[model samples]
Target: MCGIAGILRVHPLGSEVPPPDVAIPESWLDVLDESIKHRGPDGQGRFRDRATRPDGSVVDVAFVHRRLAIIDLACGQQPMVSERGPYPEKPRNGRVAVVFNGCIYNHRELRKELQSAGHKFVTDHSDTEVLIHGWREWGLEIHRHLDGMYAFSIWDHASAGIYSAVDLVGEKPLYTFSDWPRHTLCAFASTIPALARFQRAFGITPRADTHPMGFSDLLAYGFLSDDGSLGYTPIELVRRVSPRSPIGIFATRGSVRPEPCNPDPARLPAFSVRNSESPEAINAGNVEDILNRAVESRLRSDVPTGCFLSGGIDSSLMSILAKKLIGELQTFCVRMPRLEYDESPIAGLVAKHIGSVHQTLDCHGDPSGDVIQLIRQLGLPFGDSSLLPTHWVSRAARDAIGVAISGDGGDELFGGYERYRAAQLLQRFASFLRMVPSMTRYRRREKSRMTRIGRLVQAAKEGGYPALLMIFPPSELRQLASFPGRKPWEDDPRGDSVSQAMRFDILNYLPGDLLTKVDTASMAVALEVRAPFLATEIVRRSMMTPVSALMPHGERKGLLKAVARKYLPDEIVDRPKMGFSIPIGEWFRTDYGGMKQLLLDTLNSADPFPEDILGIRINRTFIARMVEDHMDRRRDHSQRLYMLLVLAIWSDWLRGLSGTIRN
Candidate 1:
């Protein structure tokens, strides 16, 4: 894993100076490098080149890389360059240079293939070298052959152009900035803060619009839109490199324009069943075979590796498979001080059953500190409560291992969430509810029972299962905001209601929330997390299976449980699903005094809460009432209140940073 940044200059026609004449100072690159040193602590490298195209247009590119040294610890230094020209032994200017973040599980296979094709590798063994050579061999098509989490940028010296791509699932992040008017710089980095600092230091004018639609989406859906075609970010000038998309920038007419490569539909995992078997005919062995291969592939790391065993079916299954494939696995689990929140005992049972070494870390302290640290590391507002425990587990695991395998995608893939069942139940009973007479009165008793049921019935009719999973309902959001109601983006139409919900999550929630949470939390501690469940093979198979097969007889993740029963005891396989969660609701009532004080202070402060920040005038009275209701036990508003708090904190942080930079 690593952090990469680069600057490219494009000089338009009739310009007084060519791009090569404009020098980007080494100190500026140093500043960019230092801004993200936390992402990679092992070492650093910098590369600079100025190339003149056939048309006499000049392009200057500088690349900086911070290394984490997961593989080829001694020789994996990068901004790695590929060997070039006929005399392989003699040193020459590299044809392609690359700085990559994230592991390539299939690098060994690719390496052997490249070697057989007459490509020579100079490193002892480094995936970075394989990627550079692969680029030389396959060009941008190299991204399709790679099977791992990655975000990379390659500078092709011969073409005077740059190529960049993020992984299929967006497990890693990349952000880009362009200052067209000044003609001074165009750059990309791993974080928004790095770009912000770069723009400030270089005096690049900030873009006029900050993309208010993004903030509107955040308020409506707890995350930015997954539609990467739209430029969405807190800063209008910066844009994210969309998942599974490649971007190219070439010096054309003495200027550069970023061209997004057309997405190859083949890159998407295509669902299929083996030998055209019916869903019922598919058995545990089929699922087990795919999962085992996925787990084995992620176990490819030079450093010591481990698994996060939450005692939930997903993580437990992953741990069991890792142990079976690689003996004596090291497993880590977080033990919350509260009994209701802790799963260490169950995890211990699984560890003992597998005969693996296990350790448990305690997460019992003031959460305010961790919340602040997480927000700072995230560089955005993410309201997932599990981030607290995920952060702790990553920190503990990093002390013992540089890489850890996780079971993040299992829930979305296998229908493991309670909401899936709830949606199904709503759909199943909607007809019965419709037959009952509507409640005509507005009394408290009527509102408590029939009114809520009516709303559910209406939601079912409208096929709003995705909205049912939201923290704040559209009605509530509209009351809090100035704008009219806006629905969240929908996924491509699927046949069944359950499959629609699953596809919705696979596109939005999985990438936007779950994957984002894991990446930010794990990388915050410099630990690489590989999700075996997210392997393309496993995901395609899971998605192909009918929802009824995945959750037979109202059992969530029924297919997964059936497979786990082969390797695990019945108790572990049959236990209720317990998510990795914090006791934030209870804490609001009893503990978390400091957090409460902070929220109250922010709400009561003299500084106006900018309506543009949330794209609505927030009802302060309603927010204050939510706090009181949670404290008084009149209502459990923890989730909604927490989301609001995160938005407020992130907004304040961004404002303060902007003020500091301007001063």
Candidate 2:
């Protein structure tokens, strides 16, 4: 819902102190502010100042914020300063300034508590102020007390440092460039390109030396992990503030970034799914109540709000609850040309049942062009094909409402992916398959699904469980990648295969791929999309519930369907899971050959990757073979080829990063 950027320079504690540059340049802030303007088109604000640490180190800071004005429109202008306490009379010094992105759904509840405890109210309702007060009340623990999807930075006037955090489930994102080794300095923002731009201001030349693990994450999976394996990012000097681990700088800034409590980015923090046999029975009614509250909270926007009614159990149920709360709601669906990939007809039924304003827009476009556009616009190499429809829907809905309730996070949390069922099958027969030797010889082209499953079973047996979710199996990547990457799944959850896979999705895929897809697609159009199922309580319940409840007798999303039956028809609840699925595979083979030509045209260029770079060097020999097999109909390499296209598109975009940053 917003764009935030800041620069912090402070000498590390006990290290020799250096006189920090107190001059905060307005031009640098201007560049940072301009880079992400689409994320917040309503207004902009900036804060530039310097403070002295208790250790006699000087810290210079500059904070810039762009606002979308979703709530408390008049008073929510940010780079907001807390002015409630009696302190230094300079009005600028010793005052906390917050630059934030995403929504705080529980701000009202926290405001009541803060007010009762002697915090004077200024804005009628500003979630930004609650953060200023909450920081005063709880310090770094403020993140724990808040229930929202957010990535925020608080310039701690008292500590002369920056305290930052993302939402617990990684729904929001924060990217950073830290030159802590050279000079205790860090620059952070909502998008990576901003930091890439900031790198020059810090006297560091921008380089695209792909962090090895980052490239690995991209190939092993369809996307890169926002939180890195060793707190590093796609670009070496950059890093992410891992979710739920409140990190900061300076002495009192609580477990600083370099000294994170848990360095692992692939597991949950502050909360993890504990493994137990005959795990405690969960109350279905409690789960339903939590979802009700979650949906209700998402409808708190001051601007006109709507629901993305996909007609699936998640979206339909979310719309039903929201309509009950507000009495009326606007719903929208995108109708695709491909019937197998469209849900508009069913969405119409749900919209009628809820009696809300509904519109179904015909979603047709140049698929290949849209794919290239999103890859560049996202400022990251994300390969989820669903981004096409998500962006189309968000762009259209942005004209009607400021925010939309999305049914994301439902699949990962409730075990809706077929991978979970694959995990079930793996558990029952993995050992037996291990006894039977994997066939060494194969026909040329992509392997059959059974062949793929056999490979996944072998990988799982060999401490490479992440391979089960890979874009390219390591066995193949070993031959294709010029530089190999380290396997990133450590501390695989202790449980049965199904539960383990569910937990893996929650910790890795949910945030890294799915949430990133939605965030990037929606934010590209400046539309706010909130996922109700990702709320803290609801996520906790899903984790605690037994695997049987989530997918009873091999039924994916069994638990959610049970809840949905109460509000949604059986026809709607029991429908096959296909929302925003792109028929790219069919497009490559059938009459929709525009995408096929584009894929060949773009990827078959001389060299798709920068050979000097740390990213995966494409062996044109290997890729051409896959293309030949696919074009000849010997193999269906839709996802694998799609990932290659995204990588190549990003490589092309990265080579063209001049003064102007693309949206």
Candidate 3:
């Protein structure tokens, strides 16, 4: 794992005086350059390419890289470039230059293929060189040919246009900024922090345009949400690019457009379908092979690596495979002080079984409802309470290692979520109940379902994911605030519940909640954390299993559990599924005082939220009420309260961002 920043000028314009030797700020570059130092501790390298003007004038393109040195510790320092004349007909012809951040698990295999095809290398340096050579041989088609998590930029002096691509699932983050006609361009460390650093150095301000897609996605998906390509970065005094589908950037002056390299939308892989096969009879060899390869690929990092053991099937299975891939792996776990919320003991058992160096941290003290502070650092409004613990664990690991492999995206792909079965059962129940007379169904005294159905009666009303993860009922949202019409569903197709639900999540929450939380939390401490379970290959493979295979016999991620048991002992595998959750549900009820005070105090202060328009007062009273209800067994409202608190913090951050963007 590493950090890369660069500039691409399309058509060099001439100037009266020769272009200044230092066009882009060295200070700005350094700030952005060192932002992700935790990702690359071994070394840093910078490359500058200058385009000559008609009158001997020149503007520079600088690519900066901070090395982690996981693969070729000795000579793998990057801004790795290919040697010329190695493959004469190739695009690079040994002329490609690249700064990459990721592990190409299949690089060894790729190397053998390239060598057989008469390609040569200067050194057994790193995957950086392999990427440059791969692009030279295949052009933009290289993305589909690779199998690993990565975000890379290859500057082919020959191609002139710098080509950059994020991994298919976007596990690795790559952000770009370009405004000048033939000048400023950048791709750097995890979040907008890198750009913020550049802003200070270059005396540039950031801008923000509220992308409608952001809100559309937020309401639909339980988690992933991006405001646009601009995100919460607040890039002012510059033209910001909108979020385009994942693609290649052949960036030069004349062609600033992003070209889509991903397959047609119609051809994208399916996520779930029903399968009649019994979990026990599913092929075990394929399961083991896919998982083992996933583990082996993530082990390609240059820095000392470790795993986050959550004591669940996913993490336990990951630990088992990791031990085989990297001998004596270091594993970390978090223990909540609350007994009901703790998984540390179970995690410890898994670590011991794998013979890992296990370390546990007790995080009982309040990070003090520090959600607002986290929002500022993260540059977005993310509502996952678990992000705090995830951040804490990654920070602890980064103290000893630069990169860590995690067991995320496993539940999303596999049928490990208990909710998956619930969803399936709900679908069936909804179908069965539809057969009853509408009058009979309506006459029943079950107020909750009847009330919920009443709200969904509006053709304009769209509810799916929100129904699953909603804190307040639609009726409650209606009671809280009076909007002019039904909720906006710009991303939804005319209130189609199923389509809207899936669309909202895949487009928004996948990137917003899950990916965002993991990316920012890990990167905040400069740790490069990779999720092998999210590999595109795994996604494609898992999608092949029928939905019946998804949640086998009413178990969440049922198919996945069977796969886990095949590779792991029943003791290590059959444990109940525990999400990498914080003790917030318990904390809200038992230790409600501090959180209540924080919320009430923040709300009372100078918050610019449209509380009158969106009447959700995220104060201490609300938290107390939630705790009160949970204790009295009135309702299960902790998650909702947590979401509200996150939103309160989020609303505060958005106001601050408004100031920055305007200024």
Candidate 4:
């Protein structure tokens, strides 16, 4: 984990190597770097360099790196550069430098492959060095060859340009602020707060619609969509260069020209893709090897690293492997007071079997008082109930370890989600009944008597499908006048509600919210959390497997179970996956009077959205009742009320951003 920043001037911004005049604002760097200090703590680097053109033109670049010392602890440093290559005699002069966050699990294999191809490596030093040369050897197409979560930038002096890319899943965040006019460009630690200092230093009213405002957009879709508006801050400026898309920043006369190196993902050499249905014939024996390699790659850091054990197959399997690979591993588990919710015993069993030092933190208190503090700490409004627990575990982990491995991506990759199994069952039913006559007829009918009757029959056949199966129903959503975009469940193409919801969650909720929650919360304390299951190689391989293979007989994560049983006990294997759930509903109802009153009062100030559209008064009542019921142990309205509370919080956050950006 590190901090990276660079500035490319279309024309001359400064001259001389390490251009002093073009130095990135110290105040701005302080703000951004400090915000992301959780990502790196051992050391930090700020490099500002420039080239002088024959016509006295200048192109300046500033690269900021905060090091967390993984891999070659003694020598690995950034911004790392490649040694002389076959064609580029002076590779240093070749001008390619990279400041990267996240690990490249397959770097060793890639290194060997590059070595076989005649690319020389001098550093027995860092995984980052491998990245520098890998980009040089493979160009923009190198992304597909790599596995693991990452966001990195490579400045190529050889091409007089800068290229950057994020992981296919957007796992590792990359945000940029580019103003071609001033030849000013900066990439920072995390979201808005890191850039807050820049806003203050430059007096540039930070773009709210992009930064913090992006939080509300997240509320709409449960995460940031592939093509939705960025966030509230100008920080949303880093448009994805696309996974395989290579961007070239050229210093032209009056403007910096950035052209896409449009590389086809399909054509990449090291590419491997898998789906839920079944593993591709081509990717057989690939998933296990790739996953192991991903885990090993993450182990390359210089600092001590551990794993978050949950006794579930995913984390259990990861713990076993981590114990085997990293000597004297530390495993941290979170235990809730609810007996059903606790996994400490299972986690402890695994730790003992694997000979790892284990610590379990009890989550037995209230976070209602911390809500405001968290909102402010995050510099945005986010609704994940898991965030607080994640915060707890992260703080605990930071005390004992610098890096902790998580099994977060297992469900998304291996058909581990129960919802996906439900989708599979529904899809099968739909497939089996495809020949029905009235169902086909219903497709052509609209609102006539026959149509209404036929549609009713169709709905019955489809199991009472909603327009969208969101946490918040669209009927309720219609009331929030400021809600952006279409209905969350209004898919571009219709399918099973379960599958649609799953896809939606993977695309938005997973990266935009879940990963963000873990990344920010953990990094806030400088704890590096690596998700080995998220290795793109494994994800692609898993994607290729028949979805049925992932969830045979509608079993959640059947593949993971099979894998887990190899090392985990039968008792542990059969245990229900409680997931990272919290008691937010109970808190909101019984203990959070201030929050309830504050939300209702805040919402009442906004009038454009009438009660009819939002069912505001009724929804509030529903929320209060839901919380009350949950507190009374009457029912589990937890998920529903939590979503409402999130919406309320986000609504307030969005309202606050209106004047800051061109909403």
Model 4, runs deviating above 4 Å: 12-24, 52-57, 81-86, 89-93, 115-122, 180-189, 210-217, 228-248, 257-291, 325-328, 352-355, 364-378, 424-469, 482-506, 592-663
Instruction: Give the runs in model 1 whose Cα sits over 4 Å from its true position.
Output: 18-22, 83-94, 180-184, 204-212, 229-231, 269-283, 425-463, 488-494, 552-554, 611-616, 660-663
As a TM-score, model 1 comes out at 0.89
Better of 1 and 3 by lDDT: 1
Reference-based lDDT, each prediction = 0.74, 0.74, 0.59, 0.59
Tens digit of lDDT per residue, candidate 4, span 1-663? Answer: 655555565354353334455345566656666666656777777655566545555566666777776667766777776535666454434657778887776777888987887777777856677777787677766776777677787777655567777676666776555553464344443455555445445555443343223433444334454542232332233343334344556666534644455445442222123244343421324545665777887776667788999888888888888877877889999997567667788889988888989999887434654545455445554666677788788888888788899988787666566545434444445544334455323322122355444433343343333212234333333343234334222332434444454455555557767787887677666777888877666655554455555566667777667666777778888887778866555454555435455444443444422232223333344445545555565554455555555555543343343332212
Q: Tell me each candidate's RMSD, in Å, in order.
A: 4.2, 4.3, 6.2, 7.5
lDDT of 1: 0.74
lDDT of 1 by residue, 375-472 (tens): 76566667787887888899988999999999899888888887776566666676775566543232122124554555465455433566655565
The residue pairs that clash in candidate 1, if any, are: none
Ten-residue stretch with the least lDDT total in model 1: 438-447
Better of 2 and 3 by TM-score: 2
Per-candidate TM equals 0.89, 0.89, 0.78, 0.77
